[model samples]
Target: MKRSTTLISVTLIFASIFSAGSRGGDALGKDSAGSENPMRRFLIEDGDPNLSAIIKHIDNMYRSKSSTSRLKLIVTKPRNTRTLTMKTWTKGEEKVLVIIEAPPREKGTATLKIEKNLWNYLPRIDRTIRIPPSMMLASWMGSDFTNDDLVHEASFHKDYESSLVGPSEDPNGWLIELKAKPDIVGLWKKLEVIVSEDGRIPLVSRYYDRKGRLARTLYYSDVKDFDGHIIPSKLVLIPEDKKGHKTELIYEDIDFDVPVPDRTFSLSNLERKK
Candidate 1:
């Protein structure tokens, strides 16, 4: 189904929250000098040394068993701007449900993703539509991000080869480049990520398309301690080609590893009136 770019923004923004959490996570824990670090011990490769461990840590920074959150999404263009308020629930690696609560015209609209399948629910028409794989690259809510940008299951540690880039602007911090393996097929030919020296928080990430052109830039800011998990509370996405266009997602509240009933992800819940 074709949707307004603004509406598409809402879906993709929530996807980012579930998948990237704006790249937030617990700080790297240290053990005794001779003890092995969980983040480094298991994933460390003999050839890459600390690079692999660092990438793995950054990739799984927001890893959790389950979560629920409320957030605001703003889509801006040269001529207009729109805002959407939404709540989302997630369990494990799959099962995500997102519902729109504000912008009355679109209230009660929802999206559900279980495993590899995705569906959209339109409250106004009371119809539930399944999103085909072909539409994965289509624009979501007219935002800078596409459908796949939110739900795509590519892994940084597995699908891409990572290497450190020296001479970074942040002293003591690191700039890492991730190039998709030749055999892996997906958007983003490469990624350049700038991580803070302390806590290893991801400050900014630049995504490059297949033609080696800059596709978009994702900026993480407004670091906040949510309960105990320290993570950026805001994410701004800007497409390289879209002038005067950007999408902003501000997390208002979140509960990690909380009890989200399985029924919360069912079709009945997706179609429920809010």
Candidate 2:
């Protein structure tokens, strides 16, 4: 009788241990599921109170001093034509001004301010016309890039919700894909931004049109150290529909945090600056 009692007690203890182990395993599996979901992680991480580093990095990139560049714009469809020389200056995210020096017939300077303000200082007409937001999607100086691309320099963190799409590899380095929130205001309906895991520089971005088609592919190449941060010296914009045509922007000179006068960003400056 004593032996049977002892055996029964041992069996009950073993069963309890087995039950506890099973419950613990189930809990761990649930935790794993939450971590693996990219959307869930993005929402939680984006809401982190400490986002100063990301914000500062974006601000420094957009608010820098003038950057001179030579842009070669190719239009493939009607004919394989190209525009040779161009120079650009950016005064923060609010203003971007470009001057085209070559192809005398089409040569002129255009200044684009944020939102609804824009002007083209046509040496030919010697007049300025205010551009509206509806025309933002129009080709920029006959290039593949739209006017909206120039003025919409808002930081991704501020304008869109970001999520890690899991570990992936790209030409640049280890990458994590980030999808923009549906309600975010921007030209692209969705964006797949490839960011280097080590450097945190955005490498390649695939932009989808409003209908969810892959409309454009933007590759950030020739990364150079500007000041203390790494910036892409060249950005190549290629439209999927326009085969054989690409816009390559080569940054010749760049400076950051320089004092830009208030007048530089004004609409009057756009019209007056020859």
Candidate 3:
């Protein structure tokens, strides 16, 4: 396929729906009376009492303040499959630039994300197009992961109300369930995440729809040291009903707390090589 055709076809898959948000992370605050929170009534605080700690670790696992990574993303759908090799530089959740580096056809194609605004650069046309709100939920780069995941529109800590699923559902690992706040928007109605108690490594996350039906599951595996921090190097997302469809993101290399130039997030740099 021609380079332009490939880009067009891949982008079209994500046109169904989306929005992008920038920052995340929220700490527990005092209730209205500055005392006990009413939500805590339904949560576990007896045995583990580590609900807050788990939430904090999960929220901060992937990135520090700034990071750079070489990622290999693979997507498979029915009769088609595609692999993309991209280099991503991120300054927190708000500022990010992902540039396709391999498969020559998409060499200069890049996406710049700053806050809620997103822009896509098409090197073939030498143009930068601002992504509209309607496209925020679209599959990003033709992967099952949406643009929302890319930009972090909803914070896992703030947007969702979390509670420990209790010891009955928890054995060797911690099981935390999160329900989206009324104001937040996304396809998932609730999410159940399992992480190791000691290593804080994510094991599995099940996404449920509004009706409480399983939508998809994200599996994390292959723990390795990315410099000083240990984290899962591979994440695979599998749909509940889609038999042959799944997306995998593998971190070839990652450097947390890496120095990112102040100007690296600018629009003009979208088409510029690092």
* Better structure of 2 and 3 per TM-score: 3
* lDDT scores of the candidates, listed in order: 0.70, 0.48, 0.63
List the candidate numbers ranked by lDDT, top first.
1, 3, 2
lDDT score of residue 34 within candidate 3: 20
lDDT of 3 at 58: 59
Candidate 2 lDDT tens digits, 116-154 = 355556666777655544555443443456545444544
Worst 10 residues of 3 by lDDT: 13-22
Give the TM-score (vs. native) of candidate 3: 0.77
Cα lDDT of model 3 by residue, 1-274, tens digit:
1333323222321111011112112232111112244323313345454676566545555545667788887878888887888777777656777778987877878877676666778888899877776566554443455554444444567779988785334435777899998888777789998876542566888988879998788888898877655677888888777788887778899876678986998887776753
216 Cα displacement, candidate 2 (Å)? 1.2
lDDT score of residue 2 within candidate 1: 34
On TM-score, the stronger of 1 and 3 is: 1
TM-score of each: 0.83, 0.66, 0.77
Best by TM-score: 1
User: What order do you get sorting by TM-score, best first?
Assistant: 1, 3, 2
Identify the runs in model 3 with alpha carbons over 4 angstroms from their true place: 1-49, 138-143, 167-172, 197-199
